[model samples]
Target: MTLYLLIYFIIIMGAVVAVISKKLINSAIMLALLSIGVSILLFAYNAPWAAVFELSVCAGLITVLFVSAVSLVKHDEENIKENRVKYVLLPLLLIGFIISASIIVPEYFSKLQIFSTYNTQKEEPIGKLIWLYRGVDIIGQLTLLASSVFVIKHIFFKRKEADNGGKI
Candidate 1:
């Protein structure tokens, strides 16, 4: 639908703007916008609960977390230097792996009878749909929550230790 396209366009544009922004705070705001766009798109697709989660967790909590991180983390020259190599390598490796998978997987998958034989026509209630049909999603969300909590705790703990002159 036209509405879906428009909402998707807004989400993508917001994501691009967020990634390209120079200021961390600006990027966080843009990310929040992107998240809101996704929530709207989800609502348009008749997934109100998913939209709510997207708005609350991705748009609200994640944006607040980003703002907190940007404000808390001191951007020193040494920190930048130490992080530069690790960040560059990680993305490069990830992109290379994605390109490899995209090129290799489709051709191989086409020959496989299993992919061609999988059932496509199925429906279930929303509760059963998420819990039974999409269990991995629940796992993934839990993983995300745990990682976020870990990162926030680590940052504050390090800050506390630094404040104590590395005593604690």
Candidate 2:
């Protein structure tokens, strides 16, 4: 229980820091931290495959893409106007929503228990489940990763073209 709470705290703090960060790189790093926290939580919940996927795709791949994208963009900090009040209030609002959901969501789920169905069959091994039952999900994840790579490559190509005065 204490470990779960600690992970949750890390996730919340990471999210808040990501949202409030002034620099894009810092935000991307915090987002990776958030994904790591989530991956840990999934592992704690006995979902190793999900945890691995979250760590690899979200924390590793997406963070790299975000950092690369942010690096490619020219920052004109002096010309950018930020509303500080929004950043200050957003985390507070998020905390309030989380608190309310914690209070309300359990009761709602408890009520739903009456209508829920349980699978009493023995669980398949993770390897069989992944390759046999969840082949489509695996393919989808691969497709998403491939598409993101292609998109990033396309962005780099365009930036290179612009840098070379459209000579490509």
Question: Best by lDDT, which number?
Answer: 2
Kindly report which residue stretches of model 2 are placed more than 4 angstroms away from their true locations once superposed.
Answer: 138-168
TM-score of 2: 0.78
Provide the lowest-lDDT 10-residue window in model 2: 71-80
For residue 97, what is the lDDT in candidate 1? Answer: 86
Model 2, residue 43: C-alpha shift (Å) = 1.6
Query: For candidate 2, lDDT tens digit of each residue in 1-168?
Result: 999999999998998899988888999999999999999999999999899999999999999989988887847643589988999899789889989999999999999998988989998898998799989998898999899899979876645566878886
lDDT of 1 by residue, 3-122 (tens): 887998898778766765556788899999999999998898888999999999999999998898788774742355354455446556757986999899988887785657666778
Candidate 1: where are CA atoms >4 Å away? 74-122, 130-166
TM-score result, candidate 1: 0.58
Q: Report the number of clashing residue pairs per model.
A: 0, 0
RMSD of each: 7.0, 3.5
